[model samples]
Target chain A: MSNIALRKIFAMLVEKLARLEIFLEDKKETYDRPNLKFVISCEESLKEIKQDLLTIYPVLAKTFEGKVVSAEETQKALEVYKKCLDKFLELHSLSSHLPLNPIASETYIFLSDVLKIKKTFKEFDSRIVLLTQDFLTRNTHQCYTNLPFVSDIEKKPMALYLPIIENSNPLYWPILVKNIFGNIDSLKASAKKHYEELIGQKASLGQEKRKILEKIALQLTYDIYSMKLLGPAYYYLFVEAGVFRSIAETRIRYQPTLAAREQILFSELERQNFAAIAESTHKWFITLSELSDEMHSTLGFKVDFSDVQPAMDEIVARLTREAESVIPEKYLFKCSDFCVSLAGFERLKKGILVASSTIEELNKSKKQCKEALCEVNFTEKTEKLQELPNTPQQIINAGWIYSEYVYDDLLREVLKSPQLDYTPFIKHIKNNDTLLLNSVEKSRIFEILMKKEG
Target chain B: MLLNKKHIMERLVHADPDKKIFITPFINPEEQVGSVSIDLRLGTDFEIVKGFDSSSKPDFNVSAEKLEQMAVKKKVTVSADPAEPFYIQPGAFVIGYSIEHLKLPSDLLAKIAGRNSWGKIGLFVNSTAGLITPDFSGTLTFGLKNMSPEALPLYPGVRIAQIYFHQTRNSGSVKTEDAGAGTCEVISGNIEC
Candidate 1:
């Protein structure tokens, strides 16, 4: 393969590497996970690959005037790129969820993130194949450039130059005289060797073949060929080489920048992780709601607030721990806020329990108060009646003074006589006990009857 | 055979979209779907059998109207909405419903039983009527009896029972007939009461 062909392939590989790196950068910026070690590993490899592409750019561009560059080194660089791509694919496949096609099952909505990442990988793989084909077949049909010479003082051509090798400094001829004067035969032999090395053919005396060999020798910076300066041929080669050199240098410089543009992490896995955490969080909330109901139901009003305190504490602690474990650190604050609200729910539940106890106590106290009030009313009425006079005669006098309705008209008549004769009324009193009487009246009547009998 | 988790998941995945076999107001599938059964939760509404005059015999044999009069329907809220819970006071019996409404396919016949965890605490959960009929779509009502020495307080949304599904021989044809029959629309017709 020609040096230009190798350079073209190298450029294509660099483009793929840069794209992969960009994808990683985007992934790192957004969806990077602390849990999946492979993601971080793939990212690290991408960074190294980017550096490798930058280092190899100038090396692959260094096809001199006549000498051909071997495809061996470029193939090795391509291998590195391919390996990186393989790593990316492996990471993607390992992380992707089971494909839904074979199962013919409707996936849970939460699995959308996984499907997205799988799509990314699928697209990445297809692009890689297309790029690889472009890399392998590019610059194969045409001779892209003739090598340019380094010019110096007096506007004279000074020495032949080659672009920088990947891991080495740039190469150029300091003097063209030594090869012309000594070992000119050996220099031709060396040019013939390079022709065979690049084109896989022996050099011949035919004009076209000789011209190609001379050009190859000049590109290799063979001292004899540089010294000779064969008239129109050298000038034609130099002019041709100048156009290619300008184009190659410009291309090499621009290539890295293009690759740099696409460099950043693009990770769907992180989005998937976020979706998973959200799904789990949703489920946790539902379970917690159910558990809260059960706890409230089981111990509810019957158990004191203190009885449920530990259980509430346990649930809160468990939820926090679970959130911490599953939820990314970036989302911890939101989860904590939710947990704090859950604690608030427990506090509200506690208030309800305490209120239930308070109401029960209030009801019991109300019942006792009602019974005590009934007893107090009975005692007050009794004490008021006991305030009557001790002597039966005085009691009778008080009753006659305060009397509104007479027990009978006969009793009223007896009382009207100021209790002078009660004998007649006593027999009537014995017969008619149904007549109403105050305590004072009854005492007085009994005393009057006793006196009369005596 | 009693359906296991694998079979259950398969059915869930492939079940008809319109006639999806499901539990509504869905909780966690991991927690609800057990090896043999699905755990069901207690609902808010309850019908408590108030102590009646056992000494005097009534002339009318107990009718629907009498049953309605005999039982007190109470809805219990767990939070501060109500101060008192529906307490199944020691030696008391109450009826409660499941929070989730179930839709079973014709191929399955399910048996509802009280969870052992609650049963150990002397809470017996049973249906007054026997096994759940296929093609049934309603919240199951359970007769809850607290045989414990202490008053057992039941708040809404607790796991009181589990329904284990068993494969029935005449499931497909029976389900089609039942769904098309539309006899279940009658409130009294569907309810076991």
Candidate 2:
């Protein structure tokens, strides 16, 4: 069949399968058992078809065992595969609106797409292999080995093509004629060693010597990155380090000592702080464990709190059980002391386990309050607060109203006398008063006093 | 008439009751309200003007888009405690914004001024773009210049500027057509001079 005819048939099949999946999904809700079986059957059939197609797919590679096949035939196969890939992509996009099971569809789509990529890359690999074999056998292809910017050109033929293909370095011819025979892992290791050397040189250079170091590192990275032999880890490290270094250099240039010093200090401080926090946490855990042990000994029972960090409620339950059921009245004093002497008892008393200590503290506070209140002298000394000049400036100068007690006393006195106009007092409070009041309180006072005047 | 403390408080009590007048994280009256104006705190974002050649006149013919490329923007997060600060060196100019985003009423116009405390240290701000017209909304941008011999540390969330709100008898609209014109949008960059 013609390539176009095959592509059309493949596209139609994909479309039909997507529609069938969607139909099965819709009917699955109503006929759960039967529809599920039908869906599974359809899926299995589709899988088998996909496998059959994969098995029969002709190798588009232009060579077998060091012999070159016709270039025209290889090119025609590539064109047919390219057309099929385009149709698959179209079908994939169109099926997006179908209500297929999301997980199943995604897994299938990913699997198919990955297979396509593998097949394409395999063809690419085959082309390289053929070209390499051709270069070795034919003297005419020997000039291609003189490609510039390739390190140990005989060992890393893939690296030469990488830069031209990825970075589009026009200085070198595209390496389409051959596949590399060298192990990719060893090539990556060499490139990594090369990178380490570049960075080592960069590290030794001072601020003034950075420009040349950066230029060299960038050039080396460009060459390696174009090769595409290195994994994502190497790619990310190389790119991120280069960008970060450039930015750091720029900042160092502008601020001289300050910017560089700040960054170093920040990094050091962060490291130290994280270490300190870890140490502190470890100490705290040990302290808690020791405390728990002490409690266990005091109770004279093996509390099965093997949990490294039991919930607070669980600890409370255990403590309460020990306090109420296990301990005698004589031991109450010991438990009370534990609760009262230690901090955090105030917040933890809500659980009812620490009620005894809370009651003791409250009783003490009540007695103290009563004693203090009894000492207040209420024998009315009719000594009036000396009235100052009513002017705003004089009132501010006296600083009497600024005092919280005095302001309250004065306001009380003014309110008692109906004849006294509270305008000046109100004005002073409105303008000069810096007392912290809630919005509701401030507005209520100001609205009654200022609104009448306005 | 300049709004006094009482008037300011009264207006705030009822002002934008539903929409909140767009001031983010509003402060209580006691914290920010002054006798004559409400204090505005410094924001974290800043645009610092780079040093230029004093020999050549800056090309004014550069478009608004081009002028935006000239200034370098920096965001300096300042701690609430006054100990850590973003320093501004002598003979340096930087742009800062108020932490609060205010939406002024149609009858109320505002003016930005350096606090007396900041001005005493030879830290000048808002020499230009001081006027905030009525109906203006957004964080006000500040043109900060440190004229002191010593480097001044500016802490964000501290009182850097005061905004005196004035009530106008004539509620005429302030022209905003030319407001954002030639204004640089990005936090920092050099203009096409």
Model 1 off-target regions past 4 Å?
A1-454, B51-86, B171-193
* Model-by-model DockQ, in order: 0.01, 0.02
Q: Rate the local accuracy (lDDT) of all candidates.
A: 0.37, 0.37
Best by TM-score: 2
Give the count of colliding residue pairs in each prediction. 20, 18
Tens-digit per-residue lDDT, A376-415, candidate 1 = 1211221111111123111112222111112223332432
Question: B13-115 in candidate 2: lDDT tens per residue?
Answer: 4434322223432433356778988888775556666643345555668885655554344544332233446789998888887655566655555678988
Considering only chain B, report the TM-score of each candidate against the true chain B.
Answer: 0.73, 0.74
Clashes of 2: 18
lDDT of 2 by residue, A74-181 (tens): 344334433433333333333332222221212122222222222112224344434433332221111111112122223445654665443321111113212321
Worst 10 residues of 1 chain B by lDDT: B184-193
Q: Which stretches of candidate 2 lie over 4 Å from their true place?
A: A1-454, B15-22, B51-58, B63-66, B72-82, B169-193
How would you encode candidate 1's per-residue C-alpha lDDT over B1-193 as one tens digit per residue? Answer: 6677777655544436333354543333556778877788765456766555455554367795675565445543232012234578877788887755565665655668999998999999986546665566656789998899999877545678888766555512333333233222222223321
Q: Cα lDDT for residue B119, model 2?
A: 88
DockQ score of candidate 1? 0.01
